[model samples]
Target: MIRVNHRSGGVLVLAVTETRLTAAVAPQFKQLVLDQIEAGNTRLVLDLSEVGFIDSTGLGAMVGILKRVGSRGDVAVCGLQPAAAQMFRLTRMDKVFRIYDDADAAVGALEQS
Candidate 1:
């Protein structure tokens, strides 16, 4: 479901491999990411380059993940496809999460934080 990569300065990059992030997989996706957060990976960059569709459930899952991190850490989103980007904008999640063009840029920003 996700390709996990550990970068320098304690940033965890989670690249979603699925094309659609909807009700069917949002729960599992949320659980997997929450597990990572519980495992001491607080800084995160969620790469959604492969995800072309995101429903309300998927957005909810992302919000849940961010809430899980809270003030203890940060979660940034990157590599959003056009549809996903539009969804984020329409939902105003663009303001809630830092959006980056790529994983490397997101990692750099989180590393600095």
Candidate 2:
């Protein structure tokens, strides 16, 4: 099961599970993010520490979420497991998103930036 945790640092941390985020769950994920944004909480940090894997749909969903947050707000990622991290690197999304070692570090950096 996939679970999303809205953290106190004002980051909507989506701690995914179940190995992969496919089309079946991408829309729901996107909607959750949109709901957060509409609630005036725009800063987001996807905590992929628990996600062992992610497919193209998952990556696309993340990109879509980032776009929704826009340049006006901060959207970051951190604590990616090895398999997921490899996928991010392979896709070169590592350059697209601000990835950190941990959630606290990401939140702090976002606050400063």
Candidate 3:
């Protein structure tokens, strides 16, 4: 499951409450982002602090979500655990996504621009 909260500074924070992000939830995650994009929000912050694991499909879903935002806004991911961080580095996705140590930092950084 996921929780999306719209905050000040046009930042929509999506918190992954589940322990793992995999094929099972990738589609739902994508759908959630899509729904928001269609509602006209692109500035997004994904809170992954609670997430314990992520697979390739989950990674792909994240990429797709970012693409959906396009150049209209930005995407930031925060609270990556050690394993998830390693997966991101291995795939070089760390370079693509703006990563933060916490939700406040992610929202602060993105809200500025």
Each candidate structure's TM-score, on Cα atoms with residue i matched to residue i, is 0.99, 0.85, 0.97
Q: For candidate 1, write residues 62-84 as lDDT tens digits.
A: 99999999999999999999999
Error of 2 at 58 (Å): 0.6
Predictions in order: lDDT: 0.96, 0.79, 0.92
The segments of candidate 3 whose C-alpha lies over 4 angstroms from its true place after superposition are none
Q: Across residues 1-113, which tens digit of lDDT does each residue of candidate 2 receive?
A: 44666666566666565566677777887787778788887887777776777889989989988888887688889888888889889999999999999878887887776
Q: Please give the clash total of every predicted structure, in order.
A: 0, 0, 0
Which candidate leads the pack in TM-score? 1
Residue 65 lDDT (model 3): 92
Off by over 4 Å in 2: 1-9
lDDT of 3 by residue, 1-113 (tens): 77988889989998989789999998998898789888988899999999999999999999999998889899999999998999999999999999999999999999898
Model 1: residues with Cα > 4 Å off, grouped in runs = none
Put the candidates in lDDT order, highest first.
Answer: 1, 3, 2
> Candidate 1: lDDT over CA atoms?
0.96
Q: How close is candidate 3 to the true structure, as a TM-score?
A: 0.97
